[model samples]
Target: MPLYKEIILKDNAKLYLWKITEDIEYLKHAVKLNTNSQNRVDSMKSESHQKGFLAARMLLQHIGYTDFDLYYDTFGKPHLTDGKHISISHSHTFSAIAISNQSIGLDIEQVKEKILKIASRFMDVSHLENLSETEKRIKATVIWGIKESIFKIKNIEGISFRNHIFEEDFSLEDKKATATLKYENKEENFDILFDSAEDYIFVCAFEKQ
Candidate 1:
């Protein structure tokens, strides 16, 4: 069995993390349950995708929905036929899912010092200036996660953390932050939440609109 850590935000969006060490059979089961294609290669890739899918499915199950449906849009954004919004992300051993009535996104990252070394490549000079050595490493991971969440909600790719990602002032004492994403002329506000559970840093963003 996998161990799951759940975070329930004050706004009601739920974030779930499953540290899966099980065999790949769960993946095969997921593919069989969701798709109709019987092509061998498609089945293989679909199975690979299921590590994240089953984790998300378990979360939906816990929330009291057994017959939920998932479909992807043209931009590869995952959506529910029942009208709920969902987002998923996975890294290494952990997979995460976030669901909400409104638009939401979730990302799980293993906290590592390497992220800090490469922070300048992803973060603007202003973002670089705002971080302190004591928290710079963790904050860098947070920005990486925020960028991912923004991408999921906006359903676009090629966004840079430095120029495209804009966020509210985050103090060292804050475990959460808010950000404003600028994709062309439009701006969307998102609330960011962070958790230092196990060896990973989990970040989630929910659109306030």
Candidate 2:
């Protein structure tokens, strides 16, 4: 229930993951939130969402930072007071945050069959071929995470997952891949690293230098 995992990425980015097993009350008591975060959590209609938000703060504290040191820009992208890049994501019962000296993005998604049903909308369907139903579900979820992570890094408007983001062909065994964001007449490359935690898939994206 504490920090579930810590990953030191190849790019030197540090990622922290937390499994949300604590009740909302316990999480509320564990971390101090700024007034804005408190109001944001109070406005959440779902207890699960609130727990996820708190779990993220719990991770911040685990790494020697607190809510007061974190803030969101006009686009809602999170940044640290010390100028480190930060990205936060929570899904189902998992919460995760990634920190890097360079720009970065992080996303986590629960593996579900539903992702396969809509895979074509955001990814190249051909990449889904030659895989079992279960693999398809996991791969689709990863691709979705890929696009979501990249979008977080760019934090720009008018980017479409189905149109601007693209993932190259990759097999599950690879455990990593690459993607490109072609938006506004410019193409940016990103290095992607992904893995499964419990039933969730988490992806991290770092812009290529």
Q: Best lDDT goes to which candidate?
A: 2
Q: What is the lDDT of residue 168 in candidate 1?
A: 73
Off by over 4 Å in 2: none
Off by over 4 Å in 1: 26-32, 36-50, 61-68, 125-134
Can you write out model 2's per-residue Cα lDDT over 1-209, one digit (the tens) per residue? 87999999865689899998999899999999999999999999999999999999999999999999999999899999999999999998999999999999999999998897798899999998999999999999999999999999998989999999989999889889999999999999999999999899999999999
**What does the lDDT come to for candidate 1?**
0.70
lDDT score at residue 97, model 2, on the 0-100 scale:
94
Deviation in angstroms for 42 in model 1? Answer: 4.6
Q: Each candidate's root-mean-square deviation in Å?
A: 3.3, 0.8
Judged by lDDT against the true structure, how good is candidate 2? Answer: 0.94
